[model samples]
Target: MQQIFDFKALVKYRDRAAQRLGTVTPVLEELTDRLLDRLDDTTSRFSTALDFGGRGVLAPMLKARGISVDSADFSALLAAKAGGTPLPLPGPADFKLTQARYDLIVAPLSLHGLDDLPGALIQFRRALKPEGLLLASLPVLGTLHELRLNLLETEETLTGKVSPRISPFPELRDCAGLLQRAGFTHPVADIEELEFLYANPLALLHELRDAGEGNALCARSRAIPPRALFPAALAAMPRKEGRMVARLRMAVLTGWAS
Candidate 1:
């Protein structure tokens, strides 16, 4: 299969950023809380849980709630920081399952970057005990639409062509289908739209970098984008109360293992 993301590079960058930035993704933190709240409302309690791709946020939260949580992350640095295990990138074969099965598995703000999301979901299902719950939040279609459009327009105008700058995200409409295809039962998907205000476009770009969400597209441009593009994109953002606003949409998915 053709590669869509440079996942290895992504892991490296994220690990380094974690070491330097010291766990700064408030969005992930908020999403983790939301997932836990959902679990609380639906189920009484989970005895054992796995925090997948949380990088460090969900494990502590689960433990605080009296759940036995084991954390796993794609970045070695992040894993070390979280005092958890490291997960290898998804490949043709499924990940090796642990001897102990989990009652719940939660992945927050992480699944969207996977090249083989279906395969990962299958692995998640197999790793869980029967009827165990899976909850995941991923940035879906329409995430950063403003930034994507601005980049496209500015790059095209400056270079006479455009290259992929933002990674493609899964559509909310397709989330349930993917879960079903992965053999997950009782799949449910919902979307949450969020808007953030930044002082300028450079602030937005800096936030993305600090969050380890910089461009990771395999087909992304090798040459540096024109400096003018940044200001142009910033200027193009919708201004509300004199602050530039960017939009993001997150798809939260839930399923049960049979």
Candidate 2:
């Protein structure tokens, strides 16, 4: 019901990421592989799939398995470039697809930004055939928590005020509940926590930018932050083996349409 994201900004950042990424984002590839690995755990056979918010990674793998794939994203450019269809991101109420059209729908690392995640999930469920599956990967609470904490502490220490700098993510326990609320059957949610050694904290920031993980919160601070904010924050990060350790927690959600 509340619009928390700036869709225009989301699309702009996504397009920039799409152009810059060009199918070579290690993080995206990692998540896609993980999602597919879960797919292998199932015995269901799918002839068609919709790769939602795909970055040109998941569809190819599915195609190789003889499954027809259609791609969609919040960015039309990305939707076309990745999946060959120029579908724009749909609002919760506006997401329309042929009923019972696809046997599988895969959404990777894209659900966290939606203002109406439950509504979107319902729409996704509606577009699937009976007994079809919906699989999605999204960042959960505590993902990038260290960075968020450091940034907030540094900013508050410097300016005595704080505004949202990082986006909020869904909690792990609530993911499956969302599916159930959307009328999914046998909904399940699990998580994988991955730690990466970054050359430095700045490298993490750069990768996020390159990945188009920019802040799109409608309430985000528009004014440029203090010049020393990032430096101060990054300097405060914990180190592991002389490198900055960044932890990413991705939640995998699964449900059957029927």
In candidate 1, which residue ranges exceed 4 Å CA deviation?
21-23, 83-93
lDDT of each: 0.78, 0.85
lDDT of 2 by residue, 107-127 (tens): 988887789898889889989
- Candidate 1, residue 234: Cα displacement in angstroms equals 1.8
Reference-based TM-score, model 1: 0.92
Local accuracy of candidate 1 as per-residue lDDT tens digits, 96-214: 66733998988888776678889888888888888889899888889888878988999889989999888888889999999999889999998888888877657877777777787
Candidate 2 to truth, TM: 0.96
| lDDT score, candidate 2, position 17 | 86
Q: Of the candidates shown, which would achieve the greatest TM-score relative to the real structure? A: 2
Model 2 local distance difference test score: 0.85
Best by lDDT: 2
- The reply for model 2, stretches above 4 Å from the true place, is 84-86, 90-92
